[model samples]
Target: MCTTKRGKIVGYCANELPCCDFTAKNTGSCGTVRVGSSSSPSAVFQSPDYPDFSSGDLNCNFQFDISNVSNKGYDGIQLNFEDAYMEGPGFARHSPCETDMIFIRGFKYWQPPAWCGNLTGYVAVIDKTKNTAFLKVVNILALMSGFRYKWRISVSLIKRSATSKNSETEMENMENELYPSPNINYADIQPQPEVRQSESRSNHRSRFHTKRHAPIFSDNSEDEEMDPIAEPFIVNGEDTNITDVPWQASIRTFYPDSFLKMASKTINNTDKFNQEKEGCSMEGRHFCGASIISNKHVLCAAHCFHGMTKLYGFKRLDHVKVFLGETDLCEDDLVKYGRKSQNYSIDKIIFHYGYDDIILMHDVVILKLKEKIKFNDYIKPIALSKRNKVYYGQQAKSSGWGLTNLTAKGASLPTILQSTGKMFVENKTYCDAFLEKGWAASKSLMASYPKYYNAYESVFCTSSKNDSISKLVGSGDSGGSIIVFDKTHDPPLPVQIGIVSYGLDGLESKREHDNVFVDFFQSVSFYRDWIDLAMSV
Candidate 1:
């Protein structure tokens, strides 16, 4: 354990972990492993010889493994040049084909093989999100150019279904089968929805909701019928202030199934949400379900995100992949329909100061994008009622890639669509009517509508005729907008009147009044000033 003149280990390069030395790390030397005099170069050395056979034959199916891992061994990394996934790097096992008791080399994130050392840029992750946790390769050049090197990879995000120990048995006969089917690959799918003439567009359409439906929330006791004054805030129409509350961007995520009667949907009907047809992709991932307001600004729920600051030590735009207009989401289908999908990065997310939970301040957030998106048939923003006119029994579309009963286990990303439902706007006085169930009050589900409804400022409450069997909004779906159609306009316009706020639980969403939305806009309208100020700074 001799310290160097620099008071560090022999190979004390501060850049690498263990800080011993890349020389020592790569060397299978016993002296380096032990804390002996280790300073003598010759005595602390072992050869870094690797075999010609790697996990893959040649192509992108590049594979690798860690040597003697379960019993403690080496790690290796695979690199890729594109946005595709990595492959192999499975468990450490004895190589039957190779003699001399060869253990799997570099099973975890370790050294690359002696192949493909000339590749410039690449991504390194092995296996899918199912059997492995995808981690980004830290040092690309070092891993790719070093004595031990492997090929850079580009693969898909799809995972095979069978995860049992018998996976070898199940897959032995099926290893050649590509997952998600050749038909399921996003390669053929549309990144954006298709815009066709409402009639002709329905031709390729398989089956899904036509109209958007409100978050079907089940009544809860914690949701007390309260006065607007119960949750204090300033009132303004189009002119809203930024300092209306304090924690404007704090988002709260909920656990749907944890609570009873939270109106969290169970796998029952396959029609409203097709559990039988497709799978859930955006299941547990983070996405900011948002509403579009005037021009370029978008209003979304604050609790939908932690904001796009840090993701696994990388800076990612942690917002939803915005799709403007579309009937189908399959990128392939969009191409067939002649529809196009444009990509835009999120620039800014402005949450109102009044944002809070249980207690209302401002749950609404406004997003600024990197560029202004062009709107067309399948992609147009919903209209906002600067006034309190669009409400009650009036039908409109509400959509989001929200939770579906059982398909929660599937891989399809949540989506935005429209369904038909009624407006439940009533008098605040009506919320006081009590409905009781044994052990709890089952009375006046409609009461909270008017109870929290603010005629002058907030817009809340939408009801579907069949409350018994319908899809509803839950956790991650918050801050998403409710697209209200205004037939009164020339284009039969759709304007976003409500930003999905909160409810008793994750899946149970209660409508925040439209007046409340206006109030938030009124208070946050000062954001124009903030945006201009922030940009200048």
Candidate 2:
């Protein structure tokens, strides 16, 4: 229900990817909650659509409303017991993480803290009667640095038992009831692209249903490794099943032309980019980044440039160039395409005001073209989804020339325009079940997590998990945009979701059963007035 430092809400996901280090350090977007681990509050929550949870009785029974998810990372439950006990092997390794774990019958687990840490349990819905599970938090938290917390628990489910009242005992009882299934089955793990690429013709898009599958449950230490993307498993549960490797992302593209052809007007250029290096060409491999909230301004990630900000922060726009029309940036490839390159420069470089100088969230950059673009046949502006949303299953494409793997990771300028389909907003979930996985009522992140929830509130998200194939933004395309074509709109609308800020599986984005996008509309939605103020100024 919260945007983790990684799902965009935890985002996988190497989630909660930010524009720069500084942005990640402080408050992040509302749709994307960045909880720090320093035991400090940073991410804040404010939803006028909901009520103020101030006057509720402390002993009252609080039932949650979880919806729209069909996976572990999507819909489930958690509970955190502060100052709780951990008894078993490797508990220390998972220490600091207050949790609740259960071993299914026949599972040989030597641990018995009955608490939480590196614990694995299979999620189940009893007879679909409740269509939800239970969790509990029995430990009280101490006030540290003026932060005193009660036992906090959360569950991520499509819907909570609306008939039941929320109470401590009911919550605790529910947590205890969720038992691990000893011989968990993986015979039904869903496949990626869940639908075949061949079947996803634009007209047939959405023909692919929102996928559902069981999240893997393994005893290995690696299963819990936090990566934005995940891989499908084919294991024999009856025979010590093990799909417990780190989530490896491998996205394969098919029928990219359908996407390219849809982009009727592209920002083309007159100059040809002569690569000083071999791989950095924009030839059908380079990703496009835009800052065109207005004419004369272009936005991109800082990493797209070869030099780091410490070294190139002061570089002028003339040194930076942009390519629009050319699919192949390599000078040699031009002979085949019979085309030239359109180039622009970085007029000024101003990182996001709160960006981290070293890491992510600081990837945003601005460029200024020498002359105003003549929104002609090839060069034009893509309407930024700066505020509104373009729904699920739409085509979200990333255009750039960059390495798609971990080792060969490289950067490119004006590379080929590559596109992927977009995963839209999944329903808000109840992460209370996640509380059972921890032992504290307090929030977290690298130590300084924000305290914005006093009662139950849901975090909204955009799903983009591609379990069958790893389809994620790759290197050099860091600041590239995630655009989805709206078939429902007038004449097939093209809406923008913000820039492709970051992914979980390093160079290979961790795409799981389904992916989630940090709804840019949520963050910038309220700031429309602010943005207008800035634009007019």
Candidate 3:
């Protein structure tokens, strides 16, 4: 220790007891690490002895400030943990949250959950909603064993003009202009279900329905009148008012055990050289989309349930959450957006028992929420079509947080719900041709599943009409609604005609005619009886 000129001791100040916990002190220059407004835009932080840290009551805090970059129009910071190995909760090793936990703060309105054990190389955290975040690490009672952890953060500070839609102010202005009030006059747009269809046009093949079974839904009581939608506001994929697609729902999956495994495998196989490579996609908490059919139930594609098996298995209802009246999943400050999001745990997953994952048939599932959803302008259920005929070409709408760009190999998700107009194509021949030739040639799974050899039955087709512009559902759009207008109703109610299923890749040049792509949707008409039965139970 150095001595002062006045003969007094000169040393760093140290707070006592709790303040000066084991890991709290700056041991080996591994104290509170700060990035962003610090010396660099990116940084690497680690425990005192990473890969071999000591034990017993370890605790420290790390902070990040990205306000400077955010003010410059940057999206936010991306934080990734490269390695984490510590003494886990003894008998409670199964609960990583209770061990030598790492706590996070300021990521959003709520406190970030604790993480412990070997979390390195498997964690990627992004702070897009706020400019700052706090991270704390704690280890308890393991002097014999040690701990290890490492982390890195990179910033995304893309510069954009004030007029760009990405601008915060621009988004606020658009939201206010589009929706002057929280609740639209839903009662005024009530549909007249008693209206009769024209006998002449009814005889001609209508482009609205082609299901074997008639429309099926619970009887409407006088107290509950189905609202009408005269015409859907069609546009290019962009953020819109939540009330625009009241039936739309965002599905999030949460399974800590499987998520950790996926993350670790991804990190172990990837390196800095190939980190940004396409197809090496990162999964978000919100994985798929659905559409509300009733206050307690929402409908989605059955295949969506199949894909989810890899994460939480086929029957993990607790791992699923349904978010209604949610337009933007990226929005961190929910209060700023006047969020009316209602999140509910799934009580049951009513999937088609005959659903063939390989053939992709009977691809429909109804999620029953533990609690019923309260109806509002932004949380209404879409009507199921009653017709059974479909015209060759008819206008419809597809909405979800799917891919915004068609050509990109791994497209980023749209921040807000993306809505685009599509046209139904009654071309069983075209669908069969692709399934027999195009799809069969590329996929090996077709050989094992004979039922998938052709698209002859139980499916409907849609495509982007404009050869130059694309507007079809992509990966994350699975289980979303394909709504069509029924003019037969008094006020023209928007009815769900189909649900998003498998589709020809929008990037496939062969499928494009003058640059247009085709997509397949599970006919909701055929699945109406299944839905009604499931909802009834």
Ranked by lDDT, top first: 3, 1, 2
- State the lDDT of candidate 3 residue by residue for 1-537, as single tens digits: 111121222234666322222432223233455555523555555565454544433456565555554445443333444454543443320123343555555432334334444433322223222213331211111211232333332222222233322322332333333322322233333221221111110000001100111111111212111111000112246566667787898887666876646654642233321222344232235556889876788888765554221222232465668888877665532564775578888776655534544445567777878898887767777777543555345667778876554332333455667887545554555555444443334334543444333234567766554545656666567788887765554344577888877553222343432333356677776655445555543
| Among all candidates shown, the one with the greatest TM-score | 3
Angstrom error of the Cα, residue 467, model 3: value is 4.5
Alpha-carbon TM-score of each model against the true structure: 0.37, 0.38, 0.50
Give lDDT tens digits, candidate 2, residues 1-537.
132332122122245553322112222222322232222211222211112111111111222222222332322222211121112222221122222222211112211122222111111111121211222111212111101112222222223332211322332232223212222233422222322111110100000000110112221223222221111111101111111100011111121465434322221121121122444433332323443443454545433431221211122233335554444444433464554335454333433222222223223444444566443233444444433432333334444443332221121223234444433433323122222122123333322321122111211223345443444444334444544443433334344455544331111134332322122112222222223322221
Better of 1 and 2 by lDDT: 1
Weakest 10 consecutive residues, lDDT, candidate 2? 201-210
Candidate 1: worst-modelled 10 consecutive residues by lDDT: 198-207
Counting clashing residue pairs in each candidate, in order, gives: 98, 125, 10
Clash pairs (backbone) in predicted model 3 = 82-121, 83-120, 84-120, 206-390, 206-391, 207-390, 207-391, 209-388, 209-389, 302-363
Tens-digit lDDT string for candidate 1 (494-533): 4445555432111122333211110011222222222222
The lDDT values for all models are 0.28, 0.28, 0.49
Better of 1 and 3 by TM-score: 3
Model 2 earns a TM-score of 0.38
lDDT of 1 at 113: 29
Which ranges in model 2 have alpha carbons more than 4 Å from their true place? Answer: 1-288, 291-294, 302-314, 332-335, 386-395, 406-415, 422-467, 505-537
Q: In model 2, what lDDT does residue 64 have?
A: 29
